[model samples]
Target: MLEINGLVKHYGDFTLNCTMKVEPGRITGLVGENGAGKSTTFKAVLGLITYDAGDVTLLGKAPSELTEEEKQKIGVTLAESGFSGYLKVKDVVPVLAALYPAFDREKFLGLCRKFGIPMDKYIREFSTGMKAKLKVLAAVTHRAEFLLMDEPTTGLDVMAREGILDLFREYMEEDENRSILISSHISSDLEGLCDDIYMIHNGEIVFHEETDVLLNEYGLIKADEEQYRNLDKEYILRVRRESFGYSCLTDQKQYYLENYPDVVVEKGSLDEVITMIIGGEKL
Candidate 1:
């Protein structure tokens, strides 16, 4: 439902070049470190920032060409910047209803209550998890067709994170055309929730793959210098030398398991894969 081609943004020394697509009915993830351009890409797609180069297609039209009605079809929740913290939950409902014609006040209030947000107090009194929940509630309460969430689960406890993810799953199941693009520092959450993942580092798209392939086929092998030299390096994508041995990442897990039966090979986690891609040496 969204496409970005050769998208480039520059700010003096820092440059961002990203290209990826988010298909309908799937949650796509963008995982990166701080200052890695995840937010920049999101802003460009939402038309909040102008890019130096390339095209961004949101829904069916260019982001800049989207009409107000079309804009309502998309929802966004940033890590920061939202309704005034001084506003009470009761006070914000009217504002939201006024902003979007499809705003479901009943559903919004129900979610707030269900999630244990107090309506009588101002938003400023809520905790970090409460504030995060409020943002997602606002985004989906309008029944948006697409969602762009940046760090939706940051600073949340395990239970809170699970609840928010469940809400996302429910939202997606409610409509066959819905899609979400979520960026988060928490790699495990993305590993579990995303259908596809795009890894970004130093403002570049380093890797993009289906989550199933990544979890099932990707592996990390620990080998010493002698063993590493003897194994087929063709399957090794990146390698980092540790105190004990070499930590290697590979996409050909089954091949390595069959060929190098003595070496220690284990399934790769999202964090391990990202670490190798960003910091380890290439093949």
Candidate 2:
């Protein structure tokens, strides 16, 4: 489990103030645009970067206070860095076995083979999907209880991405105590995998919701200017003007379905919800 309270980081122009928690046995996702501080938050949690304010607790201790043995309980895969493309996939087996006492060589090699990674082929010769799969394989095969993954499925095709996700699901099922905090640009990826979602923008977390609630209860209401004037506004969270009239985002979709039968109400997708929250006029 990981907990971050008031974690703040500042760059020249952007200041990141993030507070989020990843519970045991659950997959939590962070979604935001470029420069939205998803990576900054992950780095702070993993002690890869220094923060200006707040505290971070990882696996029951402050990130800085975790011992060497304690560090082995966590796994990491970053979009920005990892394995040297100069070496073959087989080349890192010994290095990993030497680093982690619990490294499962058999499982690692199995995952690599399952993902179609050529053990004899140099990493540089692999495609983007192969590289991404290799990174995730390395993270999970170490018997780590917690994972901090930044864009593990980036640039991957649909099948490749699903394979990695299935790996995560398998990892969690093997141990209910395990947890994963992942960030992705792909909405469908998060929608399919995350238990809950946190939306961050401009270096701040703006919304958090259970995935079921978000996908099931949330809706967008399309109403013209006349309908908008008469429609109940209590449940509406955001409103945006369209040439057709107004597009409103609401969490209580059932409430409107029962009260106003004429307005067009459509179930909200993750992308539509995020777009509306970031760009629409909040009520």
* Local accuracy of candidate 1 as per-residue lDDT tens digits, 52-107: 99999999899999999999999898877667998998999998898899999999
Q: What RMSD does each model have against the real structure?
A: 1.1, 1.0
> TM-scores for all candidates?
0.97, 0.97
lDDT of 2: 0.92
Residue-by-residue lDDT tens digits, candidate 2, 18-96: 9999999999999999889998898888888889999899998888888989988888998777799899878899989
Which pairs of residues clash in candidate 1, taking residues 3 or more apart in a chain or in different chains?
none
- Candidate lDDT values, in order: 0.92, 0.92
Off by over 4 Å in 1: none
